[model samples]
Target: MGIIDAHHHVWDLSVRDQDWITGPQLAPLRRDFPLSDLEPQARAASVDRTILVQTITVPEETPELLALAAESDLVAGVVGWIDLTASDVAEKLGRLRALPGGEWLRGIRHQVQGEPDPWWLTRPEVLRGLRTVADAELVYEVVALPHQLPAAVSAARHLPELTFVLDHLGKPPIVSGQLKPWSAAVRELASQPNTVCKLSGMVTEADWHEWTVDALRPYADTVLDAFGPQRLMFGSDWPVCTLAAGYAEVVDATGVLLAGLSPDEQAAVWTDTAERVYGADRPNQCRIRRVSPRGDASLD
Candidate 1:
């Protein structure tokens, strides 16, 4: 009946550089995409609430996003960046909690996918910082490449009390059409009671120019099977997914795959699950429309 896009992003071009976008693997994503670009499309598709995920791994980016959240009703929550490797990591997190708009900050993330070490998450310092996330009552957004899944699993196990949201469906290999290692690894992570995966970002991983929903189904199915309906959440990776398809296509294609599921199960994947996990209100949940564009609008 309603939907909460559990994962999405917003970035201002005038600020710091996103160095990851320069590579050939991501050549198609070389433009400035901000919250405005996503607002109109999300409204049309009825994706009411969104978690504004951070695009950069710098400390300053978190506060900037928290400020943005305060100004935008569309932004129901925020997953922000924190340098977990710093010596005083615990203190930093506590300090951030007292900042303005901090209530909108519901989670923390680091670009672990960019780490040189495959076992980065298992490192003592990083694991210590991850524990702080659980201690502070926030979710941890696990954004890792396929190879890094094992370390993610280890970290997740060490901090069993800390809840995790897997980003990009483990960055599956849709473009090459292989699923063995990735699928198996994802199953292991999802087997844990504390982990959940977002059904987002497949467009960028698949054959961008000539991909279809069928191409991404196997990966999405694996995650759905492993995590079940209540733990799974839908996300239109939006402007980022534009590298392959538009906002409407991403939403429509996901709807097609979900067609066979029961109304109750579909409700959780689309809306209820996110609200329960993130403590966020569904966007546009109760609004009334008038006969004309110029006519009155009010709460139903």
Candidate 2:
């Protein structure tokens, strides 16, 4: 079976500075990370397709990603940034779909993690924007911090028609080993039938240099129990995960975390869930290729 990385990102420093990539800790990510750098790594890991997600909230970035997706075979879908509070948000969505390679625009994402107000997702304008996204037959990805999960839950409950994808398990407190509030909030969000969670970004949340699969198990297990494999998908979180682990390491760790599941259940996390959630229709001609034990590409 083919695997789909549900979340990853790329950026060109020459085009625009990733303003968020500041300080000594994030220095490694300051350089450009184009799709060229990721394709090989993804192929090496047997990842047939990926969902390119937005790193920064810029209006122009979405179109650029769509164009890239149009040109690439690996990128199956894109979750882009859009100003949820914009008065003409619905019009914006329509215009975005009308752009070149717009069919790859599977979902919308905002940096809700950076918003100061914990209740930002509940704002009237934001809710209206989310409904517009739903009306457009798109999913809404929630990139929220743990404290903001209550609002995410509220938004999911309010818009049953919209599929709210919770990124990074709402970024649980892995380093601190705390689970209470984070786990509780995640369970609550998962209770909403429309809500789904990505098993990504945990490596960066832990002690980067010393993290082990056991350290990540709790957070992974929580979401698995809450959302089930059918509602949960795997994400590399790519260049960002490099802060703590390499792409292959992240993929291997996820496999270890999912070792207890049946093959069908594991298949859901590996590929099926992402395809279903993002509506990424794989064409008959676009067969997935797997790297052989001898390091040659072979049809899956």
**Which candidate achieves the best lDDT against the true structure?**
2
User: Candidate 1's residue-wise lDDT over 1-300, tens digit each?
Assistant: 457898888766678777778878676677677888888889899987898888887788888888877788888888888888677767887777667767777888888898999999999988888877777767888999999999988887888777778998989999998999999999999877778778899988999899988998888888888887777889888778888889889999889878878898788789866776676763222111111111122222
The TM-score values for the models, in the order shown, are: 0.90, 0.93
Instruction: List the pairs of residues colliding in candidate 2.
Output: none
RMSD of each: 8.4, 6.9
Model 2, residue 124: C-alpha shift (Å): 0.5
**Highest TM-score scorer:** 2
Q: What TM-score would you give candidate 2 relative to the actual structure?
A: 0.93
Write down the RMSD of candidate 2 (Cα, Å).
6.9
Q: Which ten contiguous residues of candidate 1 have the minimum total lDDT?
A: 286-295
How much lDDT does each candidate structure score?
0.80, 0.87
The superposed Cα distance between candidate 1 and the true structure at residue 125, in angstroms, equals 0.4
